[model samples]
Target: MAETDKFAVQPHADATSQQQAHSLEHWRSHTGRNDIITGLRAMHVWLALGWHDIRQRYRRSVLGPFWFTLTTLVMVGVLGFMYSELLGQEISDYLPYLGIGMVVWQFISTAANEGCNAMIGAGSTIKQIRMPLTTHVCRMVWRNLVILLHSLPVVVLLMVFFGHSLTLEFLLLVPGLLILMLNAVWSGIVFGILCARYRDVMPIIGNLFQVGFFLTPVMWRASDLKERAWIADINPFNHLIEIIRAPILGTPIMLEPWLWSLALIFLGFAAAHYLMVRFRERVAYWL
Candidate 1:
């Protein structure tokens, strides 16, 4: 009878161990880090989806994505000419500066603008599918990156036409682009959550972007604010643009902008991680 009791107790202990392991798995699965890791691992899904979005959007159009290249050229030509004249800057010097800034700003602004809808726009899939919610945000950022690439040829042409030779500093654009994309990811998660919960915030973001364009020194030079340099120094967008723009224009890369950009990355990810973990499960319902 004692032997029988021992065998029964052994099964009970095994059951309890299994239950504990299951609980541990569940806890880890619910973490934000897990979500990010799983989402990144599912890159094939987001990559295909991002490319599909671009192809579908320009499906019937003849020029397709090259339209971005043409638009960049016209925008730079028209604005570069007018702004250079009005600001009393030489055209040769100003065009390359304006072109690089415009291209970089387009990526930053477009990623941000679309990021607001990252979760909301994928509403149907979110409800029906059980994937990491961050996947949608990654898709949004990747789509904007594609657009950024399409517009890059304009930057190359501008540098060539304006006689800005490639220097070792031009390689700085690689890391600058990476940092920009990382910032976009966190911003997408944060803004995506806020806009999903508060629909009205979307239009507010749009308006802010319009004002930000003029305020951020995209068209205007930061050096023009000589006496009151604090204005540009205070704008985070200015630092973001400077990181990429300075590299392309072969200007001295300032350590301050790099510091600010890195600081923003850490702070932004902290906020994003909190919101993601807190609301990851509820995002589908919010959609």
Candidate 2:
């Protein structure tokens, strides 16, 4: 009777130890860790995939990714001409504004839209393999950035046509681009997870971007809203657009826009990081 009782006690102790070990690991993986190291380590793999995505997208096309540039160029020209006449703004004044705005806007809009589908789109891969899930978001953001690079010639052409010279201020665009790119990373993760769990969110966000096009000052000037100036000031989209656009056009970068852009990035990255650490392992199941 004594030997049997000892045997039972030992097994119970061993079982509890095993369970505790597992719980420790489970909590460790789910503790909403705040770190960039994992994402940084996975960068090489996502960079390759991002390049592949661009190539795969335009594989057979004659112009390749420049197709986007041409399409954007046409849109800028048509809109710039028509809107300039209607708004009584100079063609010279409007063309560069619209050109830069549209190109950067494409990057912002698509990065956000693709973010919603990043995890879902990579659903098969996520299920079949074990990997850092943020890689998907990284790849999507990089791919959009590649598209933005392809559209740069359009901006250059617009600047040439408008007889605008690149200024010391043009260098400001580098930081602005980096800031938006940072937002893209967080947007991809946040939207990817949310859309994976609730598929309806994807389309809802798509429609919002469509409405946002009108609300955002992508093609329009904020001066048009002089009486309602606070509207542009309050609109996050306008500030985001300004960060990139003001640099390209050699205009003053407002303190308000810079403050807003930084705030969005800081908050966005914090939220995305928490969601990633908490839900990353569950993304496959959500998909």
Candidate 3:
């Protein structure tokens, strides 16, 4: 009787171990792509929200979103002349360069800063609705993109006045913009979760942005740094900005910028997907 009982218990223990292994495999299998798919399906909802976000912000203002245009022009005018003289650079060449760099930087900075609040800003909605949280990040990106478009006239005006011509190189901007947008989306998702989990992270991000602005090559040219050019070479932000700015300026895009940008795009989305798979469920409670 004892020998028979021992054999029967061995089979039961094996079965329990197999069942536990299957459960663990299933839990680890989720790739988080579902969040992206669901958000895309609900495009109308987020697109409209994005549009409404713009309208609501400027609702009471007469100039509306044109304020972005006005502000950009003023900065270009003041900084353009000041930097041209200060750097002993030609105003014609320098102004257009500064304008393009500044505008692209504005788009990037605004998108990233807003990304930190992608989830927290929608705290009420996240707590109440069952919508995919990625949608909120999408909304923030679209809103900033629209504002960037409005600021383009400043770039165009500077180019035309400075005698820069559009060449076939302009086509490179499309791929560059697409890459930047992808970066923005994934970056927003990552920062959104971190900010929601620890409110302290947002202030740290702000300080980092201030440092990044000075570190990036917007205010100065890569040639100015010469042997120290590796500073820009290693900066992923500089590469993304250059991809767009070089095309706008009708200059050739460097091989290094493209390499760094493509590599970053792959890494950024992969990391974001991993974060979503792990912590997405906990976001609501953390809020």
lDDT of each: 0.86, 0.83, 0.84
Error of 1 at 32 (Å): 3.7
State the lDDT at 89 in candidate 2: 88
Q: Sorted on lDDT, highest at the top, how do the candidates line up? A: 1, 3, 2
Top-lDDT candidate index: 1
> Which segments of candidate 3 are over 4 A away from where they belong?
1-33
lDDT of 3 by residue, 114-195 (tens): 9999999999998987677878998998888888888876686778777878888888888988888778888898899899
Residue lDDT tens for model 1, 85-195: 899999998888888889888888888889999989999987886777778888989988888888876777767776768788989998998899889988988899999
User: Which 10 consecutive positions of candidate 1 have the poorest summed lDDT?
Assistant: 24-33
Clashing pairs in 1: none
Per-residue lDDT tens digits for candidate 2, residues 1-287, read: 99999998998999999997985554335323632446545677789999999899989889998888889988888988999999898999788888888888888899999999999999999898666677788899889988898897668767876788777888888898888888888888899989999999999999999998888887788778889877777888888888888877888767888899999989998888888777877788998
Residue 255 accuracy (lDDT) in model 1:
99
TM for every model, in the order presented, reads: 0.88, 0.86, 0.87
Task: Record all residue pairs in model 2 with backbone atoms less than 3 Å apart, i.e. clashing.
Answer: none
